[model samples]
Target: MALGPIQFYCNTAVALICGIALWTDCSSRRISNRLILIGLICTGAVVLIEVYFKGDWQNAGGRLAAGGFASFLHGIPYVSGQMGAGDLKLAMVMGLLLGWDAWHAYMGYYGLVLGTAALILCLVPAKHKPWSLPLALF
Candidate 1:
């Protein structure tokens, strides 16, 4: 699907935020709540504009539902302590920006990449295995 100007801008912003998240995660081994909040606020603003000003409520709602769904799906891992809250928030923001189709594609690619990395990490016994999938994702 072709992205409109607002969608394009939102996607770009998400990409930039993801890069920042990656750097912070790698350097500090933690993704900050402030960064996640920035992304959520920015994406929420875009969705609000689309729904209120552009009268594109259907698309906006769909994207929001997708994000909610992603949050729920990722929340399981977060609750289990398999992933961090920031990662869950990041996944939600990505779903909000990409919608269902694109989010699905992105997750498929992410799973493939992450799975491969995990497999490789398992092969070589190291003192520490990478703890942050979000950093590897970015």
Candidate 2:
């Protein structure tokens, strides 16, 4: 599938939020609520832009569905205390980027890969470092 500028924008935006959160957490020993909220707003704006500017993306229903799915999981993770508010914000951002078959595959593929890595991190013994998956896949 041909990649569009929005995908890059979404992924970069998410990475920026996550990186900021990770940095603030490391530096201050806490996640800033403001940062998380800002990230969510940024992500939501991107989605709205895509919907308004692009065609409804008749072929991208799968991506739309994936976005909804990720949002659902984001809630679960938040409720379970597995992820922070910034993380949920990032999910919403990425979901929108994956909109309407822009990547030719469902946006969920990105989340699945990410969640799988997260699962491995949780399940893996503390001895090994977590492998970083390439961000381009999103």
Candidate 3:
């Protein structure tokens, strides 16, 4: 399907969230809590605006924000978690912005690339410690 205004918004929000998550260590720092909260508010505002001003029911931004929030909440259940709150937040945000037509094909391809890179990193030995260091390399 052709990308519409809503789709563009989704792509942009996801890009922004991903960029922030990649650059900032929201997982380890308390400051990330504020950032995530701000992000949620900003994203939620976009959705509210769209719904009221643009009559948008399919815009993915609001849903993405909620999903990101849910992901954060889910992280609380684990003693030590594998999924990062930022990553989960980003995924939900992307999903919300994607709306009903979330280009699963593209997501699948990207997931494959990420998994391959992760696998390759997992195969490598670490000098400093025994734990996996793929994230450290980046």
Best TM-score goes to which candidate? Answer: 1
The models' CA-based lDDT, in order, is 0.78, 0.59, 0.54
What residue pairs are clashing in model 1? none
What TM-score does candidate 3 get on C-alpha atoms? Answer: 0.61
Candidate with maximal lDDT: 1
Model 2: how far is 45 from its true place, Å? 3.1
What is candidate 2's lDDT per residue for 49-68, written digit by digit as tens? 65677754452454566567
Which of candidates 1 and 3 reaches a greater TM-score?
1
Q: What is the alpha-carbon lDDT for the whole of candidate 3?
A: 0.54
lDDT per residue as tens, model 3, 46-122: 67877888887655444655465544544563227654545455444444555535546435755787798778667
Query: In model 2, which range of ten residues has the least summed lDDT?
Result: 129-138
The collision pairs in model 3 are 60-96, 60-97, 64-92, 64-93, 64-96
Segments in model 2 whose C-alpha atoms lie over 4 Å from true places: 57-68, 80-90, 93-138
